[model samples]
Target: MSRRSSKIEFVGSQGVPLVARLDLPEGTPWAYAVFAPCFTCGKDWLAAARICRGLAERGIAVLSVDFTGIGESGGDFADSTFSSDVDDLVRAADHLRENFAAPSLLIGHSLGGAAVLAAAHRIPETAAVATIGAPAEPEHVVHTFGGRREEIERNGEAEVSLGGRVLHIRREFLDDISAQPQAERIRRLRHALLVLHSPSDETVGVENAQRILDAAGHPKSFVAIDGADHLLTDRADARYVATLLAAWAGRYARGSVPAGPA
Candidate 1:
C-alpha cells in the first residue's frame, strides 16, 4: 500500500502552465483518475491531498491539478470562467493520455464536481464520474461574489474576498457560469454517475445532489456523508470518501482498461 507522488505541469486550455501532482501506487495502478478540487481551492489542499493519496493506496493513480490562475498555476484569475475550467479538465485528460494512460475516472469536489460533469463528454475514455458536494448548476458558486455580483456586472470586474483571499471577479466569468445548461449536461452524461453529499453541508445543500441524480439516467448512485462538512476537514471523513470512491469507480474502470503505469 505504499505510494509515490510527483509534481507535473501541463498547458491549460488557456495556454498557461498548470501545476499538478500525480499520486501513484507502489505497483501498476488498476485505473487512473483525474481529481478536481473545490472552487478556489488548490490541488494540495488538505482534503484533496488526502483523497488522492488514499485513492492511490487503494490502487487508483490520481492526477490532481490547479486550474488556470489558481494555486501555483500561471494565469489571471479574473479571466478564468466555468467553461474554461471544463476545457482545462479536458486538457488534463489529454496530458494523461499522451504521457501515461487515459484517465477512466473523473472525481470532483464542490464546484469541481459540476466542472467534471460538464467536461465528461470530451473525455471519451472516462467510464465513471463521481462528484463530492457538487452543485446542480455552475452558477451556484456565484453566491461567493456576494453583493459584488452587481458591481462586477456593472463595472466589468471587482475584487472579492473568497476563502480569505482577494480574487477578481469578472463579468465574463459570471455570464459563462450562468449560461451553463447544467440540467441538460447531467441528463446527457454518457458515463456512470456517483453523487456524494453531506446532509449538514452549509456551503452546498444536499438537495443539489438529489437534483443531479434526478437529471442523470440509470447507473447513477448517491451516498450521504452524514456529519461531514462541505470541505471534509476531518481526516477520517476524507479517507472514507476516498475509499468509497475507489471501490465504486473501480467497478466501472478496471474492466475497461489494462493495469499498467499511470
Candidate 2:
C-alpha cells in the first residue's frame, strides 16, 4: 500500500475516532481541500486515494477521511445516519480550520457528494463544491438497503449488503434517510459548484448530474467524465478527474493565489 503523507486521528461529534490522510505540497500556505467518499466506501478506496494524492501533489493540501461508522473509524455502520455523515464532514473541516488552514474546496463522490452539499452551507470557509457520480436524491441509497429495511425496523438492526460487502443498517439510520430530499438541499447551496458524471456510470446514471446542475445557482459548470464508472476504477479515469479538478479549481475566483506545488 502507498502510504499517505500525513495521517491524522480526529474525533467526530459522536465521539468516533475518524481516520484521515492529509497530503500537502511543501511550502504551500493555508490553501486546503476536503474529500468525502461514497457510501460504504472508505478513504483507501482506489480512485479516491489516487485523486486525493494527485490534488495534494499540486499546491493544495487535501484531506480524505473515513466517516464515523465506516472504515477505521470507531463506530458501528448500522447506527450511522446521513445527519451523522454531515456532522462528520463538519468535524473534519473544523479540524482543518483549527489545526491547519480553513479548507477552500469540498470534493465529494456519490453519497459523499450529497453530504458535502448539505455541509457546504455551514462551512463558511469553503469557496467551492464539486461532486462526481453523485445521486441527486438521498433516498436513492435506500434501493441498496432493500429486504433489510423492514428487518432493521423490526429488529432494531439488520445486516445488509453493499459494494460487495455486508453492513448493519439500523432503523434510526433509515429514518435519517427519510428526512429530506438531498437534491432540494443542494439546490439551495450558495457556493460555486462543479458536477462531473459519466454517461456510462451504471451505479449512478448521468441523469442525477443533470438534476444537480439544474438545481444549483449560476457559476456552476458540468463536465462529462468520459469512460468513468461510479468508482472511477481505472487509473486513467481517476487521473482525468484529478486533472480536470485542478484545472477547473484554478479558474475559481480564489484561483488567484500564487502557484504553490505540483
Candidate 3:
C-alpha cells in the first residue's frame, strides 16, 4: 500500500510550536504511534524517517516530532531539559488523542527513549513502548558533552558540538538529566517493552540495554542489532528495526492492558 505523509505543527511543553511529520498508511490505520528521535536528531533524520515510513507501510500511522529547540521546532536548546522532553511527549500524545486517536505505541531513540519510558505512565492509552540505543540513566548522555561539562558548570552554558552540529549545553540540562529517576520509571513501566541496541554501538554501550531490560518486568524483550551502529544509519538496519517493531507491536499495540496500575 502506498503511504501518505503530511506536515503538522503542535504546541509543545514550552508553549512553543513543534514541527512533526505524520506518515499514514493507505486507508484507515489499525493503530497510531509516536516516534521520538535521538538526542539532537530531528524528526527528519534519515533513520527516523525511514522507520516511520516502514511502520506506515505496515498499517500504523506514525507521528515523528522535532522536540523543542531542535530542527524546525521553536525554543532554546540550552533552556530545555529532560523533564521538558517527557512533557513534550505527553503533549504529542494529547494532540493525537484530540485530532486522531490516542497513541497506542511509543517509540524513542537514544535519550528520546529514556524520555518515553518516563512519560509512558502519564499516557494511559499507550500499550507498547520501544527504545533503541537508549541509556539506562538519563545522566549517561553527559558523556557526549565531553569537557564542555566544566565550561557549562562554570559559565552556566557552553556551545558544544554534537553530531557535527553546535548546541548550547547548560548546567540546568545536566541537573535535570541527573535528577531523573529513570530506573524507578522503568521498574514501574506498565506497557510492554522492546529494547533494541547494537553491541558495537560506541555511543551508548550494550550494557545500558541490559540494565534497562533487567529493570523492566514481563512482556519485555530485547533484540541485538549486532553490527548496526547506535544511529542505525544503514537503510537496512533501520528497515529491519521497523519491520521487527511492527511485528512485535502487533501483540500489544491494541487494547493490551497493563500488568498492574502504573
Model 3 misplacement above 4 A: 255-262
lDDT of candidate model 3 versus the reference: 0.91
**Which pairs clash inside model 2?**
none
The order by descending lDDT is 1, 3, 2
Tens digits of per-residue lDDT, candidate 2, 69-121, equal 77788887766788998888999999998998778899999989888898898
Instruction: Report RMSD for candidate 3.
Output: 3.8
RMSD of 2: 2.6
Model 2, residue 123: displacement in angstroms? 0.3
Better of 1 and 2 by lDDT: 1
Error of 1 at 55 (Å): 0.4
- Each model's TM-score? 0.97, 0.93, 0.96
Candidate 1, superposed: residue stretches over 4 Å from native: 260-262
| lDDT, candidate 1, 14-119, per-residue tens | 9899999999998888888999999999899889999999999988889998998888999988889999999999999999999988999999999999999999
In order, the Cα lDDT scores of the candidates are 0.92, 0.83, 0.91
Error of 3 at 262 (Å): 30
User: Of 2 and 3, which scores higher on TM-score?
Assistant: 3
